[model samples]
Structures are given as C-alpha cells and as structure tokens.
Target: MTRAPAHDLNAEQAVIGAALLAPNVVAELAGTLAPADFYRPVHGRLWEALCAMQATGQPVDPIALAARLADSGDLGKVGGAPYLHTLIQSVPTAANASHYARIVADHARRRQVADLGVYIAERAGTDTDVAEIVATGRAILDQAAAGSQWSPLIPLGNRRHLPDFPGYVLPEWVANMVYGVAEFTQTPVDLAGCIALAALSTAAGGRAEVEVRGSWREPTNLFTVVVLPPGSRKSAVFAAMIGPLLTAERALVERTKPAIVEAELAARVAGKAAEKAANAAANADQSGRDTLLAEATAAAMNADAVTIPVLPQLVADDVTSEEAASLLAEQGGRLAVLSPEGGIFATIAGRYSGTPNLEVFLKGHAGDMLRVNRRSRSPEHVEHPALTLGLAVQPDVLRDIADMPGFRGKGLLARILFSLPENTVGRRKIGADPVSEQVASAYTANLGALVMTLAEWTDPAVLPLTPEANERVLDIERAVEPRLAPGGAWGHLVDWGSKYTGAVVRLAGLIHLAEHLRDGWGKPIQAETVERAGLLGDYFAAHALAAFDDMGTDKSTRYARLVLAWIERTAATTFTKRELYRGVRSQIPTAADLDPVLSLLEIHGYLRQLNAPARTGAGRPASPSFLVHPEVHGSAGTVHGLPGWASRRPA
Candidate 1:
C-alpha cells in the first residue's frame, strides 16, 4: 500500500515560528539546516526567506518577515501575514528551536530514503550500466546521510600528515649545502633536498646502474618536482643548489677545448685533400681517370672518418619532448632538464600542438629505447636513454597537469618524486644570513669533481650492495607489496608506490658515491646508506600523499575541487543546478556532468540541497537549489569542503 512521504507538519511549523519569535536561533542552525528540511513547499520557502533576511542583518520578527516575504511576492503564497503570527503562536517556546529543527531534518531524510527506493526500482532493469546505477544510488544515500542530524560525514580515505624531511639521510657535504641554502633562502628544506637528489642524478645518471639482485637493475636517474607558491624564492634555491652543476659543465667544456680544436682542424685538412683529389680525377685522361677516381674515393672516406666532437651539454632548460630526445641522443643518451619554472609540463601537454607527446618523458625515466623520426631532421635512436628532471614550480601546476590526457595513464606522473613543501609566503625573514663562502666553494668543488669523474665512463658500472644493505631493501619490498592491494594504505597510489623501493635503491647508490667521492668505483653500498635512503623514501611518501591529494588523485575529488572553487569565487550562498552549471560550464559541460560533483560536495559538508518546488502539469520539475556551508565563507576556522590533510600547510 502507498503512503504519504514522511514529514511532520507540526515540527516544521514550530521550527519556523520559533525562528520568527527568536531571530538569533537561525545563526545556531546555519550550516546544519537548509530550507529543504521543511516538508511543505511554503514552509521551506518561508525558512529560506528568514535565513536570507537574517544573513543581511535584518530583524526576523513577524512584521519584518511579512514585509520581506511580501517584497518577494511570497507573503500571499505562504498564506499571508496572518499565517506568520499563527506560526509564532503555535510553538510553546523558542528555546527548543534546535530540537524542532533536528526533527524537521530527520523527517526530510526519511522522505529521501523512500524516494531512493523508488528510484532503484525504476532503474533495476534498463539499458544503463548496472555499476553506474549502483554508484548513483549510493551517492544519493550518502547525500541523504550528510543532511542528517545524527550522522556527520567524514572525509574518504586515510588522512596522513606531512612528515619532516630526513636531511640527515644525505651525505654530510650534501646535507650541509641543503641546510645552508634553505636557511639562506628562507624556504622549506624540502625544495633543496629534492633538487639535491636531482643534481646527484644528473652527475651519476646513465653512468651507473644499481643491481638490487641478479638480473634486476635500477637506473640511477630521478625525476623530482618540488611545489611552492609564488614569491617563495624558488629561483634562489634552485640557483644555490644547481650552481655546482653549471660550474662543472663549464669546466668540462674548457677541458675538452683542445680535443675539439684538434678534431675540427683534422676534418678541415681531410676535406681539402679530398677536394684536390676529385679535381685531379675530373681533369685526368680516360686511362688515368680510373686511378684518380680511386684516390678521390679514398680521400673522401678519410674526410668522413675525421668526426668532429659535439659539445657536451649536461643540462637543458625549457625544451619540448622532441628537443629533449635530440639532446639525449647527442649527449651519449643522457641529459637532465633542470629548471626553476615548470614549462616542461605545458610542452608535454601539447602547448605547441593539440596532442600530448609524452613518449620521451616515459621512456627516459625507465631507460627504455627511444627512436625519433621527425619530418626535417635526421633519424635519431637512443639505445638506453636516461633523463633526470629537477624542477620547482607553483602548486597550481600540479593540478593543471593532472587534467591533461594520458598524463597519469602513461606513467609519467608516476615516475616523478613529488614534494609539496610548506609555503613560506608572508612569514619570510626580511634579512637572513647568506650561505658561507666556505660552504659554497666546498659544494661546488665536490659536485664538479663527481660530475667530471662520472662523465668518463664508457660503460655503466653495476653498483653492488652489501649483504646487510640487500637485506634492508628486501624488507622494504616485502612491506610495500601488501600495501599495493586495493584496500591497503597505498591503494590510491599503487602506481607511484610500486616504484618506491626502486627509487630508494637508486638513492642509495648516489649516497654511496657521495661518501667515497674520488674512488667510489671500488666501494660496495653499505647498509647505513640504504637505511638513510629508506628514511628519505618515507619523507617523499608523505609528501607524495599530500601532493596527490592536492592534485585530486581521484576523478570525483578533482571535479569536486573545481565546483567548490567556483562556489567560493562567486560567493554563492544558494544556487540551482542550472546556475552552477552556467558558472562552471567550461569545465562542467552539461547539467548531467554536475551529478557526481555535487554529490561529492554534499558528502564533504560543502553544500546541501533545498526542497524542490511542487511540480505542476509540466515536462520537468523546478531545479533543486543548494545552500552553501557557512564554513565555506571563512566563518569557520577552515574550509571543510576539502579533506583534513588538504587544509594542512607545512610550518
């Protein structure tokens, strides 16, 4: 048998009457109550009018509410001013308004659950996918629970805190520079630490590989991106850390100047001799022409054999994928793209063309072979390419690149080690001490020595790990394997976590080399070095959690952030589905696209829907309006629209 939708006429009338008698009662119920909680349409409309008037600092007595309702042509619609007084008189006292409001909201949720049952019944057998139908149904129930008085919504997933950087894990010299530069720039040490690893990658990458076990080799290359907002002095930090690499690159060029000069001169002399031989062959008689032709061929072969050396380029900035690939091929299949800005993502996202080109970035990180065939350029092939990336970019760049197609699916984002350091804006010291000259010079000399020594290797040396070190790596692998499962802590980050242990092994190799410096070739990596790398690994894992969460690792979370940003920008207290669609039309194309996004916001205490206006004999019902949470306006200490970890910033 059919029954009326769940509602309490007395409770709804009493709640409204209590608010009319005592205006301050509305403020206590701002976030928890919405007009839609009232069962009757007219009562819901009256509640909305009361909240709106109180929000503008107007009185909410019978006379004021009557005038306000009359102005909106709702006075007659809600049964005139007489009904307002009747409502005031209906409630025994205004003290129990909170209790009455909860009752009203409870009835509203009951009605929604009844409607949900009907919706599931209607969608049980249809062309729509069953999984999609189930997901939508669950979203409706979650939204209904979000509006309940007894149940408050908690954010999805485990919220983790940002861990402090393990600076001691680095070799002593590298740790000194990292600390000095961070203190000098007044930025987070995280930026300097990540860039330090990338600098080590540039020095040792492609020159060595870590043999974790038999037939399992990990390349000593890394892709690291540090995120900071503007005015954080990223350039200053980058310049301080990368200073040694630039100096070392210059020293290499200067040291190779004599060889380059000799090769160029040899090629020019051979070309001249080949020209003379050809000229003689053209002038010779038929009998002598054959012998002259042979001499000319031999001379031309000699000229071609005298190959000129290409300039050594250890670093490149602001390059497209094609340009990076070409530089790698020319530089013995090794290159590092180190930059203060993150324009490389824009290029990879197809800033030049409409289609994304991520082949080089993917293959470069994995040491996979890359064959490039461009229209007007010579064919280039890299047998084993290794590219290192060290960049400092604004926090918004992470969010922007996550939306690019195939950016995640292609494993490009997974390959990177992300660090979201605490933003230091507005808190920086006016005058901080600069890095000591002694520290600066020591860093430059040691880093330059490492780069020059590594550059001479014709074949990559396999880095051996001591028994204790190998055991430590095995322990980490065993611990990480279970977490990659769908319900584990690393479930949301399986792709990045799968490579975490490998990244630690590579870090161990770099640390071991730094410790020995001059004669690192003879040393086997120690357990202490591997332990230090593991600590650094933990630091990165915590930061990656924050970074990916900010990037909206899940599709629903990402879209929800877009919708919430719009709500904040427009200061929308109450809006219909149509209104929100128009506000975020570019990102949210149609009304249907807003379903999941709105549902997500509902789950996070951002917004709640108002009661739908009664339907007449029409094609469609009026659009449902939603009340934006008071916390969204900074009235609350933090924006509750996002998860807890998302609101946290590094101190």
Candidate 2:
C-alpha cells in the first residue's frame, strides 16, 4: 500500500507565497522552512513578487492581490483556497505605515547597536581604550555599503538608501553611533536607532513582522512578532526572537548606565511573584494528600469498631505478654489484672495491658470477668465467675454446641444439659430408644428456652445453627411396613442395585427383572429404569460383540458362545442366540459372535449356498466376504463381515 503524505507542503507553499506578497506583510524566515516548500517553484514566484513590489512604485494590496490570485489555477491547485484566504487576511495592513516604519526602524536599530559593540570589542582586542573601540566601529561601518549584510542600514523603496558620510554626528548623523558614546556619553540615539535597523532585516523574510515598544523606567522593550506558516498562529521562530530581543535590551541598558533603577526593581518583583505561585501550589498539593490520608484512617477505624459475628476466633488459649504488648501499643492504653480484694495480682496497665494476652488473665482468674469496654473508648475490668470463663472458649466449639440438640447459651446451663447421656433428652430417656415424654418436656423447658433466648440475642445470620442441623437429622417419622408392595420392592431393588459392584450388568439385570415383573407378574414398574438399563445393555453388547467378531476365529466364537450359554443356563432360561450373544458382546470379550451366528445360521439352513472366492497373485485362495441374512446382522447388511476361509476351498 502506498503511504499518504503526512503534511501537504504544496498547500502550505501556496499560503506562504500569498502571505509574503500581502501589503505590509512581515517575514521572519530565520530558520529552515518546511523541506518540501524549499524545492517547489512557488518560493521563487513569491520572491519575484517581493522584488517586483520593492523595485516598482506600485504597492500590492493583499486582499485585491489574493482575489486576483484566485484566477491562477496553480494557487488554488492544492484545494486550500479557504486556508490561503485566511492567511492573507492575517497580514498587517499597509495603512499603518508609520507604525510599520517604527517597528522596522526599532528592529534595525537594535541590530546596529549590537553590531557596533561587537565590532568595537573585537577590534579593541587587548586595547581597552574607549576611543579605540569607537574608531573600530567607524572603520567597520565604512567598509559596509548601504544594504550590505553588516551595514546598519535598510533598503527603503530604492529611493531611500544610506548616503556616504565620513564621520558621525551626536544626534543628527549619529544613526551609526558606536558603544563608546552609548556607554560614556549616555546617548539614547545609538540604542533606539540600532533597534529599528534590526526590525527591517527581519521583515524581509516573508514569515512574520516584529513590533517593538521601549520604556526607560521599566526598560519595557517589548518585541511582538506574528507567527507564520500562514495557518499557524504560533510559531517557534517567533518565540525564538524573544531571547535575542532581551539580550539586545540588556546590552543597551548596560551601555547607557542610567540611574533609572525602576527596571531592575520591576524584574525583581516579577521573579518573586513567580516563586510565590510555585510555592503555594506545592503546599496545596501536600495539604490535599494529608487530608485524604486522615479521612482514610477515620474510615478504617469505624469499620473495625463494628463486630462481625462470623469472624473466626483467635487460636490462642491465653493471651501472651507479646500479644498484650501489641494491644497496648495499638490502643495506646493500659492493661491490669487485679484480685478480688482490690490488690494487684498482675498489673499490665498502660501500653502493655490491652495486649492479646488477655486470655492469660482469664485462665488464671476463677470468677467470671466483666469486659467493660466501649467500642471506641478505653476498656475497664470487673470480675464475675460465669461471664469471665465464657470469654476463654473457642468460637468453633461454641458454634457446634449452639447447634447441638436442645442446647443453648448461658455456658453453665449448656454444660449441665450436655452432661446427660446421648439417649437422654432431659432426665428420663435411657438406652437407644426414642426420647421419653418427660425428658422431652424438660428439654423443651430448660434447653429449648435457653436456645430461644440465645437466638434472639445473636444476629439472624449468625444465630445458633440448631435449626439447620435439626432439618437434616434422620429419624423414622412414619411406621415401618413388614413387606414391600408390588412397585415398592422393585423401586427398592433398583436403589439397592445401584450399590452393586458390576454396575453395568446389575443395571441391565434390574432392567430385565423390571420387564419380567411387568410382563409375567403384571406389576407395573417405572419406565425410566427400564429405558436406562436397555440403553446401557445395548451399548455394552455392541462393544462386546465387536470385540469377538474382531477375533476372526470359530474357536473364539464357540468359547464366547459357551460362556454366554453357561450364564443363561445358570439364570434358568433357554438363552436365545441374540440374548447370549449380547451378554458376551457386552463384556467386550476376546471373541465376537457375528461370524459364529452366521455359521450357525448356515448350518441351520437359514443361509443357502455361499459365493466363491478370487485368486491372488501367488495363485493361493483369496476368501472374499459377502452379505448374509439382514435379520442376523440387524440392518441392511450390504457391507460384508470378515472373510470365511472355508468359503475359498479348492474348487
């Protein structure tokens, strides 16, 4: 695939030409133009227009000129007429002639001033005398003619050109004054005139125009250049001129050396303002990060305060000193273990008290302890025998007990109820018999009541697992019957048959039994079991028969047939060849019954005279196989089985 052009340089070139010829148009072609535009013929045409305009008396109006350009199919060739028009319109108006002249003059003057200083400094090499520097500048200017690259002069419509002058005057002929008078005599003519000259050279490039404004107090030498490339309103070339302009301004200031210190003060103020803005932004960012962190911390603390009932219990039996230390560090509080007489048995108060070792205190204490701690506040301790001991229990064990038959909360009562024998409900049930009425009543009164109370106290999702356990408990709810009804025995047998090791055969047998029971006994059984068994048996039989047939031997078939006959005889039935064949086939035996069945049918006169054989290349007999009775093969037996060697006997 052909790659499309990234930029349409032909279109850009047309716009550039239009922009350059426009009246009062300024050019700042300091750097390389787009490479494509450089090789195009349009650049020469634009240059010719500029030369023609300058050489002739007639001035070119960008609007009228652009309108005429519309006829030149070449200009509109790139299909960018609209873009070209907008670019032409952006060119500065010629009507602002004085303003344009001032800009041109200021640009040229700055260049002249810089050139004068550079020339003086170069010539003064090792000679620091101000007069020598002045003489060096004059000599350089004398060598450069009007419109020369190094000259501090601008070409003005061919009629206005620099005249030949011997020496320079202070004010009138001081247009080419050197840095000596500019620095020592403190003249404004040298600096101002140099700026105007630099502006003129820049305007000839056909890209952008520069306008300058000067201030003594603030030294506000503003250089404004319009960006070029026609469509681009901002170009790097325009921005680049700012650095040179600032440099020229500083040079002018140093040469003048006036006491107007306001410019320096203004610069200092601007610098400080910039620094203050940067500092404030940095501080605001830091403050935002700190506020976010604080909010996150508060949210984490609030979540931790709400207890989840399903939360797994800690495995530790007693809180160790390490755990206590950690808790103390986290809470920034104290832990204390005291005696009933108000004497300190063990005081781990302060940062060490609330550590995970609280279990140790519970294990040592006899009475139940009161855990008086607000969720968000410091915890206090009170001792009570029953309450304290419960805190030491494992959560999983507690969950299991709560789910036990008729057990409840209040550890003392739950323990008392658990102490009874497994068969005993409350106090009357004994042995492996059903629970007595008296025991049931007591259990309902004491254990059941306690369970109900605990259920109410706990969260719904985390209430005792008792209800779930009770639902799954196995028991004889209905009276047992002595004998199974007609369908009942078969249904139970099918279920029991599922437990047999040889699942396939047993399943098949169950199916046959169901059919026998249904047909002979006239007992209707579910049709699903019969269907499933039939399907499974057919699959097994097909596989087994295929295995035997693949053996391709009469002996193999006879042995397989014998196995099937024995099975049928043991089961007390005259096994039809089909049924006997299926049982052997279902086991995927070494011998298949298909050939044997064919042989049997042949002997039984079912099959008549067989076909002959073909001769091989070695003249040996080739026993070709053929179709037989379709009923024996089970389908349209167009396809033959294995070759029968007996069919190929010497004819």
Candidate 3:
C-alpha cells in the first residue's frame, strides 16, 4: 500500500488565503515558496495565479486571481469564487504568510523525496554510472540546503541580510562617511569597511607587522571577498572607496619616471666608459693597464649609484604570481589585488597559470618570506610580503570558484573574509552630494599619512604587541583554539578558525594605524584597539560559520538524497526491481541510471535486498526485491549505517 504524500492542507490554504487577503504577501513569499509547494491542486493553481498577477506588478486580490484562473481554465476546478472566499477565510492574519509558505515548502520537499525514491528503485539495476546518479542525488540535496532560495556559502544578494553600518563600531570619520557614501551608490555599508581595511593595509604595508605571540608575527594584510549580484554597484563601490589609492600610485609612478630616464641615461654613459677602459687595458702597458682597470671599477660604481625608482604599484587588479612577486619586492612587500568583477579568483585558479596559485597567495597573506623562481628569469624573493585582496563577485561567480577544484579541501577560500549583504540597488536614493568633503578630507589625509609613513621605513622592524595587547592575543587564541579542538563546536570550520587568531592581530594592527598613527608607523597597538579587533573577529567568525556550513555539504550524498526522499514517501515495505521501475520511471528519466542510487540505498540500510524464486520452466534467475526499513523516516537516521558514526541529520 502507498501512503499519501506528506502535506499540510491547512498551510496551503493559509498561504493562498494570506496572499489573497494581502496582495503584498506575494512579494515576501515569492523567493521561498513556489506554486508547486501547495498540497492541493486547486491551491497550487490558485498560488500560480497570484504569482502571475504579481509578476506583472498587478494587484493580487480576488478579482485578479479569479480572472487569471478563469483565463487558464482553472477557476472551475478550484471551486470558483466561493473557493477563493474559503481560502481567504482560512488565514487569521497575513503577517506570518511567509511562515505558512515555509510549511508548504517543507511538505513539498518530502513529496519530492518520495518521488525521487521511485526513480532510484527503478534505475537500480540499470546501466547508468554510479557517479551520475550520485550527482543527481547531490543536486537534490543542494536544492534542499538552498530550499529557502538562500545559501550562506553561495550568497545571492536577493536573499541576504545586509549589515547595518550604523550599528557597526567604526571610527567617527568612517561612520560619517558611510551614510553618504552607501546611499549615493546604493551599496552595503560593509563595503565601506572592506575598502577601508584594504586602504589601511596598503598604508601599513611592510612597515608594520603584528606580533600576537612568540614567533607568530603577521602583517596587517587583509583579504576580503564581497559577494553581490550583477549591477548591484560592486564596481561603483570599489572605485569610489579605492579610487584614491589608484590616483596616488599613478602620481607616484609619474613623478618617478623622470628619475628613471635620468638613471638609464647615466648608466649608458658609464657603460660606454667601462667599455673604453676595457679596450685601453687590452693594449696599455702594465702600469697603464692597472690605471684603466681602476677607472673602469670607479665608473661601474658610479653607474650603480644612479638607481632608478621601481614603478610605484601598490595594487593590481590582475597579475600572475611572478608579476605580483616582483611588485612585492619593488613595493617593500606590500601589495593589493582588487577586482570588483572577481577576475582575480579566475586568475588565481588558472585562467592564466593553468593551476591554482593559492600557495603564493597564502604566503603573501601570512607575510612569510616568498621566493619565486621563473624558468628564464632571475629568482625573486621578498621578506615579509603582504598581499591584501579585495574582490566583489556575483553569486554565480562565487559558486564557480567554490566549485573550483581543491578550494574547500585546500582551504584556499577559507582564508578569505566573506561578506554577502542584501542588495540595496532599487531602494537607494541616488544623486546625493559627493561624499562629504569633511569625511573625504579626513579619509584621504589618513591614507596619505600612512603612505608617507611606509615611505619613511628605513628599517623593517616587526611591530611588537603591548603587554595588555599580548594578553588579549592570548585570550583570542584560547577562545578560538578550543573551538578547533576535538568535539569542538566549530570543528566543521577548523580550517578557517585555525587562522582567525592571527587575522585578529593583523586587524588590530591595521585599525591602530588607521586611527592613531599620523607621521610615524612603528607605534605599538593600544589595548583598546586589540579589544575592538577581537570584536571584529567575532563578527567574521559568524560569517565564516555560515560560509563553511554551505561548503561542508558533502558532494557524494546527492543520489542518496533523491533515493531517500522517494523511500520516505512510499508506504509500501517492499519493491521488486522491475516493479520499482514502473513506479519511478516517470520521476527519474532513465531506468538504467538508478544503479548507483539503489545500490547506495541497499548499502546504506534504507533498503534491504532479497531474491524471489523465478516463475517455473524458464530456467530463470531469482528476481530481486528490496525492503525499505520500517523506521526510515525524516528524523535521526543514517545514509550508510557506518560504524562509529551517529545518525546524520539533514542540514
């Protein structure tokens, strides 16, 4: 006997009723609940009508819904106008209509799982590769994880919650600038923080380093990836905030060009002198030869003294590891990579290198000594290199990088701080006055001072933590270390959590310099700055957990998810191999492809295999039958029933 699919008729009625009662409900529920989520055919059709009306920006009242349904020949099946009245009467209020929709969505998922199981059973003995079946299973599970149409790991701006900058603990100047700036661009205030951090890191450069504990000093470099949808002002925000740095670098390069030309000309003159000296030495008497060699050495020394400035490049949008290494050497190991379109991720992941260049990036972030040797070029090395990466990519691009090979396992992405704020594109009031001159002046002045401070660095001494700051650093270590320990709360994010302590110290150094340092850069960070940086660590920890959760969803369990959904929906205990195909063929396209799903099902204890005697006289083999576990419901359970593992729950 087949059990009727799980559904909440009242919830379906309430969702429809709420929408009919309040047309505005359509907007809120549109992202999470689909028309097929409704349990009843009439409810599903009615919800579809409401959505169709909403799509055209029309009112979703009774009149509009009825017209849509009647036009689609669905009005009669759903009890016409009277049924609409009954649906409207089902809801007490429209405030929780979104909640009601959630109920509908949950039941719909259960129903889908049941349907997927039928497909799994039918395809179990077929020709489909196990990998394909597993992929489909993984797809279903991914759908379930993102059932709310929002993934914390794979951020979609349409469904994220934007951070409140006014609520953030920022410098008074930054706080003041954020309101006018975010409003003008309709960007999240968090973007302000990201850009500010980058500028601060660029300012601090290789001049300042943070020593959190013994032998664990990290440069004040930051890597922030802000996820947003296309046209949500990512490029605009990036340009507005980072534009000043670009200007400063360009101006520096221009100023140095004259010296560079002079140095090259002087070097050429000295080269000719050295060549003439060498020729004279070839033919001169013994005493004359000695004099000529001495003159040549003098000329070579003079040529060396006429040094040209390297191009002043503090930030690059896209560059290979080789190029970046050279920049770090030229800029005293302080460099930034900023791209609003997220080309940097692709660049690092082999659009140019044919292999991920994460090793160089990781070394740069850690401010470790980096040595890069190219095939035909002299080996370049930098001591204490700092690479600050600021990237803004659409949700799809983030997904692409997340799917890139070796990201999660290599923890390449885990090193980055991610911000996915709700989009404010359509809601902002644009055309505000240019950023307040007072705020702009302060920001630029601070950045200029930071640049000059780096310019004044004759000695590269590590910045030591104050005694109070050292204690706070220890506290941060103690706080995050336990979480990475065995049976810890954040064991899932140990890869990221492992480095957060150092990140906090680096953040403290940046904040201290950005706020307090004026003409000089070697001052120790204050205790208050350490405390504030710890607060930021907490904030980033929350975001990291969200990102890791999405990334942690295993890739192999996909097919099993579909099979499990199908199994849960059926009331029947046993299904023969051929009989299962008949039931699930409609849901799963190819009967031959379910081999992995069914084999997985039996292997996991969701189903048990048995052989039945074949019918007489045909010398036939025994027929296969699978019995689903009686207790196989949606609660605590196992997919594989492996030893030393608890029943895995759906995320």
Give me the candidate number with maximum lDDT.
1
| lDDT pick, better of 2 and 3 | 3
lDDT for model 2, please.
0.29
Best by TM-score: 1
lDDT of residue 391 for candidate 3: 82
| Candidate 2 wrongly placed segments (more than 4 Å) | 1-51, 54-87, 91-93, 126-133, 139-651
TM-score of 1: 0.65
Supply candidate 3's per-residue lDDT for 608: 61
The better candidate by lDDT, 1 or 3, is 1
Q: Higher TM-score: candidate 1 or 3? A: 1
lDDT of each: 0.82, 0.29, 0.69
lDDT digits (tens) for residues 569-623 of candidate 3:
5655667767766656644556675776677665444566755765777665654
lDDT of 1 by residue, 219-319 (tens): 89999999886788889888999988988988888888889999999999999999999999999999899999999999999999997777888899999
Q: For every model shown, what is its TM-score relative to the native structure?
A: 0.65, 0.14, 0.59
